[model samples]
Target: MALLDNGVWSKRFFSGGWTDSALDHPVVEPATGDLLGMVGLATAEDVNRAAARAAEAQRDWAAASPQRRAAVLRRAGELFTEHAAEIEDWLVREAGSVRAKAGFEVGLALGECFECAALPTHPQGEVLTSEDARWSLSRRRPAGVVSVIAPFNFPLILGLRSVAPALALGNAVLLKPDPRTAVSGGVVIARVFEEAGLPPGVLHLLPGDASVGQAVVEAPEVRVVSFTGSTPVGRAIGEQAGRLLKRAHLELGGNNALVVLPGADVHKAASAGAFGSYLHQGQICMTTGRHIVHESLLEEYTAALAAKAEALPVGDPAREDVALGPLIDRRQLERVHAIVTESVAAGATVAAGGEVSGSGYRATVLSGLSTDMPAWREEIFGPVAPVLGFSTVEEAARIVNDCEYGLSVGILGDVGTAMKLADRIDSGKVHINEQTVSDEPNAPFGGVKASGTGSRFGGAAANIDAFTETQWVTVRPDIADYPF
Candidate 1:
């Protein structure tokens, strides 16, 4: 099952054809702890070279016709579609994703590519009113080079969400995926665009750690940065980007809530909450960390959710037919377990699976949650769900709004009442009759406050805003007399 053979990517380096670096980072399979292969480690100097090359190649790429740019993206989508099985294998072995999650991530990535392909044909500028007799226009221009720093969870979708759009809009990209998932997240991307006929240096996937990411952001040639990770890391990146006067689209951590309002079916609401909390082992940023249920339904909802969590099969996804897979690494496993233990210490009662199984955690549910509990306050990026009870609708809204992280929220109830309640919840996305773990390729996908830089990545409007810079131009047939 070793995949780094000569038939596939055999280079010491990941992409952009840099193979002379002697430094190497081992690509380990998370589930089985086997060495997949060795990828060349990138230095800050390599980042500088890559950025300079990207800047150099971006000029010609931006100058190409829109149809040509659109065609390249379309072809990339086709390549993703054709290589779905191979890519999913890499995801399973590299990122420890279950088959279904891996397949869904690839499908979403292809959808993102197709959606971005239309950016080239979309209107790039707008006519503006001019007080003077001259014509005024607002034109959209590429941001030169964009730096994309994606996390290990949902690597493919997160990486492609920003990469494809920036490339489609004529901006060069320097992607730095988490080293834990370098092959599936970064290497596969380079291969797709390379086969799609993207010019050399237009895209470079450099798999490295935090320092490499910092170098990518600090590169003089890079204009915009798109980051998806924790809030603490995001704050540092945002601070640095602010100092450099570069725009950073930061999608950070979340303690999103799944509120079961009155009149909703307790079983159905529990099903939604279970899916939100346990999907992909709850490693997603939008995972439902807190379940706020009506006091009358709290007991029933908690029991139903615990039953679902107890039934889910957890194992090495590459080897078994399972619902949940191993955590990405030891660090994540420790962090998740620590949060669960701390919450239990804080008087939370474990209702379901609480122990670790092999390299992964079992689906866990906790009741009697307090707002001050670690499981309730912190973003536990694991299959751990904490339940809280509220007496009234206002109380439910208060519980949902109490969290400082406002990424996404779910309210299970009538559409009319849910719409009214959604207005009260200060989140970037709200799901009615659905879970917080949801995404649409064409919808605006981002968060407010601690969640992210607020509705920055999604449909054409947001993508254009993130990857392009607006320039106001005025034209005069003749030169006017100067005041001087």
Candidate 2:
């Protein structure tokens, strides 16, 4: 495959249509600094048009039979399966994911589409009967216009995780994908909606930068905003939506922690911890940025983890042997660099891998970290793993809960010991014997505290709550005759 130059954008699909125009940012391979292709940039007018089209199509789409909606969603899953290789290629090229990581994300996306399709049957209503010649019932109705704003990390899967559920519930969708990987994966998803024989305008893909997104959020027609990204941007989107009195579902930033206890399998825990933090170069919201090690085991545990991190293949993301990839852009690289620099100034020791090569930063490990260091206090959002020493399991658990952001936490130790610690951590999700990466299409995923508001990607049950509104029907003919 030939690498592309800067100034060329590829539009896989859009509201107006597919147009491969030159985008603003040149798609560059992180490790090699090789240009791949340009991503399409959507303008404010584009958002307006997309929102209008979705609103126009929503009435009919919401009225479509549940069975029919489910069939479309099923077909989408099949289409995704058939095009798995192509999608994986795009993920590697655009998002800089290793082949294994790309494959995992694609598989998750397919599963989400399938799970979302089955939601119609799962969205059940409640029935009530009254003795005084009156009856009541409640049903879930579509939320009309749903605007899905996705992050770049898991471009395809996370994007679909939000939009698929909305579409399956008979809502018209306007998709605003991450600008970095906006071309093929997102376009392919919109194409799936089209292939499923969805009416025109039922699903609109507007790929662009921040201006386009701000416009989409401000549009009067877009009633609900589903967003995933950093805390600052998520807060801005929430404030904008609040101005319009619109509904918002946000899954924002995380500073996940991995606690290693004295009784834990040092080797097993070290390997899992390395991958959880360094995979995707630590761009994941659920990535374990903090390693809270028991004081008794801190030295040996850090050594084991440093070796595992050193052994990871840090080469081309497209290669099957590679386990780590480059930071998406220079901005992320700088952010990681600043956090590491600040930690060192605060007296944290760099244990391993803290160098920057081209767009990729070395998988970093820091020890002797104090709670006051920026790396310990904030979401590093990089491969810099900072280890903090803790005297007791209670202290370890307390340190994890002290962060303003409580998204996910990983506890590694004996089954009984881990569970006991887990009972005290104030995070949205907890993992035992592993890093904080658990997969259950039916499970709820989100954060608490400053991690942002609400939740998303939960199974059919929770999605039913997100995409639908409840209406209570009543029969009170006798009450009409009597005034208050």
Candidate 3:
């Protein structure tokens, strides 16, 4: 698992069957600082090459029978499930994921692939009414070339959510996964498609940094761009894609809220809140960034959440049995801790776990947050749960709706009340009694406002809009010329 080139993957790190780039970056395991492997660093020119090759291969792929495309996608899912253990190990070492988190990501990726396999046979077009005596219809065609840019956190799932559907719908993809997690996010996908007998050049995996991604969005062959990362980066990509007149489906950052209503079971609500905020070291986009509780349960809920944080374990996920793993790198650790410190300095209280634990920050709970503190206002992206107390249900909803990013929100308490309050929030995903960290293959997942471009990425209906284009055609027994 420490090396990139096993029997499963050939060419070490380059699996696109293209000429290897001279520049490369060493993938280092952050928990132990061990050298994992080397990944290619692609350039702007490499992006053009990949786009051109994908364009060439996409024509025949779109013309291929639907059964052929379905078979390839289904086989890829099977391969992923069969090698789940090995892939989990890679995720642990390369992406700093705990065993449980790694397993969840692999399962999600497999399910996404399986779901997309059924997309090829799904209805493609519909009949249209014509004003004249003619047969009229609309046809769904591939977008030609799709560019998928993924981030390091939850890389495999994010990358495949778009990659599988685009490929299944007859569109070629140029995948630009974050260089830090190239093996798990980029190479693994390329290898799986290769093993599944995807035609050469149809799926190009380019592991690189931001510059190559910019090139991918600007490529002439690319008709659409799907990006999942921070809000700032998604914004930049959206601007660039807008200038190019391309569709950019972005799933960006979230300062999501987990609200605990007045009548909820304190212990149960605290458990859900803890999991939502601290899962995977709070690296997920839908992590409960804000914990809004009714004033009646604030004391008990915060104490219970802090106790859970104090009791949990954290360490090297690859070597030890722990509930949480290290942050992706030192940069992440610094960013997380800085926010906690700044918030505490601004009159917030650290209920539990405010210290640095090796390469990670311990699961932290900040109480007495004034809603203006950084820990409560900003997207910490760490295992820090900031609690804000509210007096009324209307006030709680207002607190939840105050964030700039509207990605996901979770409300616990009375189901009727929760459902009623859900109508007031503007997030993309809402969980009535569950936490914010959740997803399903059949669900349309995306965000609104600063979180994304108000477009979704999962489910058949959403995928059709994301990966394909529509054209109208009319036939009337030869060309009965009109308005000439």
Question: How many clashing pairs per prediction, in order?
Answer: 0, 4, 0
What does the lDDT come to for candidate 2? 0.81
Off by over 4 Å in 2: 1-13, 19-25, 129-132, 476-484
| Candidate 1 residue-wise lDDT, 1-484, digit = tens | 4222433554344446545555667889989899988766677877888999899999999999998999999998998999999899988988888999999999998999999999998998999998898999999999999999999999888999999999999999999988888788887888788878888889987776678889999999999999999999999999999999999999999999998888889989988998899989899999999999888888988999999999999999999999899998889899999988988898999999888898999999999878998989999899999999999778888899898899999999878878888888889899999999999789999888899899888899999999999999999999977899
Q: Provide TM-scores for the models.
A: 0.97, 0.93, 0.97
The pairs that clash in candidate 2 are: 8-38, 9-22, 9-38, 42-208
Write the residue-wise lDDT of candidate 2 on 150-182 in tens digits: 888888877888888999888888888886777
lDDT of 3 at 387: 90
lDDT of 3 at 279: 92
| Model 1, position 28: C-alpha lDDT score | 90
Model 3 regions lying over 4 Å from their true place: 1-18, 481-484
Return the lDDT, model 3, position 148. 95
Residues 1-484, model 3: lDDT tens digits: 3223544333243435745566788888989889977777778888888889899999999999999999999999998988889889999999999999999999999999999999999998999998898999998999999999999999899899999999999999999999888889988898888888899889988777678888999999999999999999988999999998999999999999999999999999989988998899999999999999999999999999999999889899999999889999999999999999998899999999998899988999999888788898888899999998999889988898888989999999999999889999998989999999998877999888888876578889999889999999888887787796
lDDT of 1 at 214: 91
lDDT of model 1 at position 476: 95
Clashing pairs in 3: none
Which pairs of residues have clashing backbones in candidate 1? none
